[model samples]
Target: MKLAMKYVILYVNDFEQSMRFYRDILGLPVKMEAGTYVEFDTGATTLSINTRESVNELLGLGLTADVPAASSFEVGFVVEDVAAVIEELRGQQVPIVREPVTKPWGQTVAYITDPDGHFIEICTAVG
Candidate 1:
């Protein structure tokens, strides 16, 4: 089977806050938005955010627990300079999970968490 469209839907606790983090802070263009649902154009893939209440209603299941506490999954953004991005994020008061550092594979990488506590990585390849 072949895929026509790819999207990563994140269930966020606060819809507006998450939207601001992606749309305003990250500067991703909004592809579409309807009430509590928002989709951002992330080049090849789409990143969407939906309220947890909407997700529970759609699934017909009631989940009162907080957002999932998992760090194994992350959305990565490729940038030209990791340090410059980190500095910008710092100015925006975004939480920095890890400082920009060169990895063993010759790539500079940094980590930050979104409003929903989802991991986001900013990276750049080094020669």
Candidate 2:
């Protein structure tokens, strides 16, 4: 079967903090916002955030925001300039874990984390 990805939902601990980071700092437009869940309009695949309590209530699974030390996956955004984005984030008092760097393949990339510790990658388009 052919599968298409629909959304990436982050079960965040602090809903308000994560919302500000995504909506204000990262500057993603809100597509939909309910009391417990918020979805951002990010192309075909929607980037969303929800509360931990809702996940357990809906899925019946004890989901928590206790992320691992090492990130298993990252939500990446393709931007015009990685350095510019990093600078903007810095000015907002957001702690950037990694500065922009050019890889051997010639793509500039940087790293930052959201309030709930989800790795966010800011990079230029792939060659």
Candidate 3:
């Protein structure tokens, strides 16, 4: 089967707080929003956020009670300058998991945690 579109859904404990963080703080354009869901248009793939309650109801399971560890995975974004972006995020009082550092493979990366403690990596390729 072929995929027509792709999306990453993040189940958040607080819908409104996640929405504000992605839309206002990260500055992602809203694709659609409802009471318990919000989708951001990220050009190629969609990034969606949903309330844990909504997901639990949909799956008929207690997944909300089994929140994964923060460092299990991370959402990444490619930026022109990891250092500059990190500085901006710091100014906004965003929690920084790690300061920007250049990797041996010629890339700079920084890590930050979202409201729900999800890892977010801001990185740029080095020349």
Highest TM-score against the true fold, candidate:
2
- Return the top candidate by lDDT: 2
TM agreement with the true structure for every prediction:
0.89, 0.93, 0.90
lDDT of 2 by residue, 1-113 (tens): 99999999988888899899999988899999998899999899999999888888999877765746327779999999899889999999887989999999999999998
lDDT of 1 by residue, 1-127 (tens): 9877699988888888998999999999999999899999998889999887988988966644464753559988999989999999999999999999898889999999998788999998457
TM-score of candidate 2 against the unseen true structure: 0.93
Query: Total clashes, candidate 1?
Result: 0
Residue pairs with backbone overlap in model 3? none
What is the C-alpha RMSD, rounded to one decimal, of candidate 3? 2.0
What pairs collide in candidate 2?
A: none
Q: Which parts of model 2 are misplaced by more than 4 Å?
A: 67-70
